[model samples]
Target: MRTHWLSSCLVLLITTLAVAQKNTQGISGQVLWKAGNFMPTIGTKASVPKAVPVVREVYIYALTNDKQVDAGEDAGFYQKVNSKLVRKVKTDKKGRFSVTLPVGYYSVFTKEEKGLYANLFDDAMNINPVQVQKRRWTKMDVVVDYQAVY
Candidate 1:
């Protein structure tokens, strides 16, 4: 009798959990340069001797209302599952890039720099709408300035 009741309860709990799960979509967007494009024509060397264009890794982070658990959080809900040192990708010949992020709320930003270039995400991070549907692709185009706080 007890075993029967326990099995029934377990099945009910499993069913409830399954029903509560929702399929989340992924979002992808591109970052393009507005005024100062940074690519070159064919036969151009990788590095330009005179001027060093914006050469750094750009990362897209998923956000939940500006509150997040860092490296000390437990491996549960609201945990950083895919946290790692994202590789640096250069912009296209036209200073454009694209990245795919999991479905959730997020804001796109770049790291800070010094001297002529300063950290952009310091004051305000460039924010945009993020919506990832199961069968649909949410496209966003972002333009980042030289000095903007995140």
Candidate 2:
């Protein structure tokens, strides 16, 4: 009877640990935006654009290849994303957000008035690629600067 009880307790402990580990693994980050005129005048002191936190919806999709996204005519805009969307989360007023996902690679984007926006790409052309590891939280920041002139 004692042996049976011990085995049951061990099983319960292992199950608890597995659940805890799964819950702790995912991604967290903030979204920032840069907008307005950035061009500097020759006689005036150069005023660079400062990035500010923006509250918006963040979309997570499967690791997307270059062919999965359609480029817009305007800079930094995407007309469409053909990849499968995994999840989406809204940022707080301060632009901070966190999400739980299984361990794997994902592509992230922000909803834009024109469509979707993402400014990053890997060497292999993966759009805004991020990796979530087991028992770890991957930190990533999405910068929305499509309306800003550089």
Candidate 3:
């Protein structure tokens, strides 16, 4: 009887943990970096440009408008942003990262040496905008390629 009771308690604990995890929502995705020559060469022995997984820090900020970001001379680099930073996460060796956040719209940026980097925008000019839904993990893949020549 004692063994039965202990087993029941263990099962209850596991179930509760699983339910708690399922109820939390956030974002999960990978980051890739493309560098060097990306333009196609017609000559023989030409190789395709490849993007590799990059291990870096990812920043989540409140949904940012175009005016909020101070654009840099390069395409994707930002000098700074006026939006509030919501959270930050570091990517694993394989460039995979996950973060728990409330359901809302957010802007994603990857840490760079000079500044922050993000290459996407919406119709309203929202920079790197992502939406986190209730009880769901939003998937977003960020590619950093400011150094690469097109």
Candidate 4:
């Protein structure tokens, strides 16, 4: 009787583990450089360059998408709880990036170079992120105004 009970318990535990693993999903996304300021040539004395610089070294964070959790406080919450690196990725030569993460809602974080570099979406990316669905394989898009801090 003792051996039969132990065997049954082991089987139950294995089944639970298998079921949990089956529910996991993979999440992914890409990053791009925001368009540069396009001043009208007709009005300006000097024409601005049409090409934009590539952004790099942007860091991403994951957070729970709950009603009580203020979306505006995501960065601060991540800093307090997930201060360590969740994942690190860089933009390719064409300013494209892809990262694979487990299914979960996440907030995007971008690091802009402190020097003469100009990054527009630094604060916004740090502020709030849209709730990401985590069921199966998923993909999303991210844009950065300034280059990521290397």
**lDDT over C-alpha atoms for residue 26 of model 1:** 42
**Candidate 4's residue-wise lDDT over 31-101, tens digit each?**
55545555466655874534343556656555423332332332232222233346767777665665656
**Which candidate leads in lDDT?**
3
Q: In candidate 4, which residue pairs clash?
A: 56-148, 111-149, 119-146
Cand. 4 Cα-lDDT: 0.49
- In model 4, which regions exceed 4 Å deviation? 1-30, 35-55, 64-84, 115-126, 135-139, 146-150
The lDDT of model 2 is: 0.89
Better of 2 and 4 by lDDT: 2
RMSD of each: 15.7, 7.7, 3.7, 13.1
> Each candidate: what lDDT?
0.42, 0.89, 0.91, 0.49
> What are the runs in model 1 whose C-alpha is more than 4 Å off?
1-27, 34-56, 64-90, 112-129, 147-150
At residue 32, candidate 4 shows an lDDT of 54
lDDT of 1 by residue, 1-150 (tens): 999999999999998855544333344344543334345657866542232234334545553232332322321122231333223344555445554445555544444332111112323332333555554556655454443222
Instruction: Show where candidate 3 strays beyond 4 Å.
Output: 1-18, 41-45
Models ranked on lDDT: 3, 2, 4, 1
Give the per-residue lDDT of model 2 (tens digit) for 45-99.
8678788999999999999987888989876568888989999999999999999
Highest TM-score against the true fold, candidate: 3
